[model samples]
Target: MITVLIRLLTLRAENVIPEVIWALMAIYVLAVLVTLTSVWVTFKKLEGRLLWSLIVLLVPFLGVIAHCLYCLTHADVDVLKQFGFFTRKTA
Candidate 1:
């Protein structure tokens, strides 16, 4: 098993860097789109323009994660209340 794993690792090392970079780029784009969708949905639900611009300007994957965490945990109950959408409720 160890020998097989070592062989596989050696083989993968030959082409893994480019493949990993491509995957990261794809994930980044997907994250950006998800963030944009989240912001749009949030705006549509809440009828406010508070964080959309700021979130969109951030680096994609990290930005989406940040926005999601903030929306889920922050104490802005009024926003969630106004939209009738809470993370816990959705879960």
Candidate 2:
């Protein structure tokens, strides 16, 4: 049994399975959907929401990846500050 397992593990595949490809595609689609939903929910203004939605929809995979990186880097700062979406309060 151990020899059989070792032989199977040592074998290399020449082609990917159709089911595996479909599963991967499905997962990617799901991720895009969830990311789009999060973008809509996170940005309150209509303009900001529309801009981000267009970005994610137009660029697909790269848009989501870029957005993820942007969020990670700016986790502590006001993301919409540059766009003048929010006004600063003076004490």
Candidate 3:
């Protein structure tokens, strides 16, 4: 089984096109997964499912940018505040 697997890998490496195509497909799948996860997490945080979904699907890079900005601006304040975090101190 090991030898057979090695032989298959060797053959695949000999053909650069197939390897390249496979790499591209893997990268595309990874990017899609990352984008979907990002959008889902952002939606969960923002509670704006429909609107954010549309924006994420239609605008490339913008979804990620929006998510990052939202996280940066609100994550520490709003989200954390819910869990008794970032409470104000009385003077």
Which number leads on lDDT?
A: 2
Which parts of model 1 are misplaced by more than 4 Å? 1-16, 45-51, 59-61, 74-91
lDDT against the true structure, each candidate: 0.65, 0.74, 0.64
Q: List model 2 lDDT by residue over 38-75, tens digit each.
A: 88877789998888878888996998897788666666
Error of 3 at 43 (Å): 4.3
For model 1, residues 29-91, the per-residue Cα lDDT tens digits are 887777777777666644344466465565545667777786688547877777776545643
Q: Candidate 3 — which residues are off by over 4 angstroms?
A: 1-32, 41-47, 77-91
Q: For model 1, what is the C-alpha lDDT against the true structure?
A: 0.65
List pairs with backbone clashes in candidate 3. none
Per-residue alpha-carbon lDDT of candidate 3 for residues 12-61, written as tens digits (9 for 90 to 100): 65445554567656776676567667667656655576667666567766
Ranking by lDDT: 2, 1, 3
**Candidate numbers sorted by TM-score from highest down:** 2, 1, 3
Residues forming the 10-long window of minimal summed lDDT in candidate 2:
6-15
| Candidate with the larger lDDT of 1 and 2 | 2
Better of 1 and 2 by TM-score: 2
* RMSD of each candidate relative to the true structure: 8.4, 10.3, 9.1
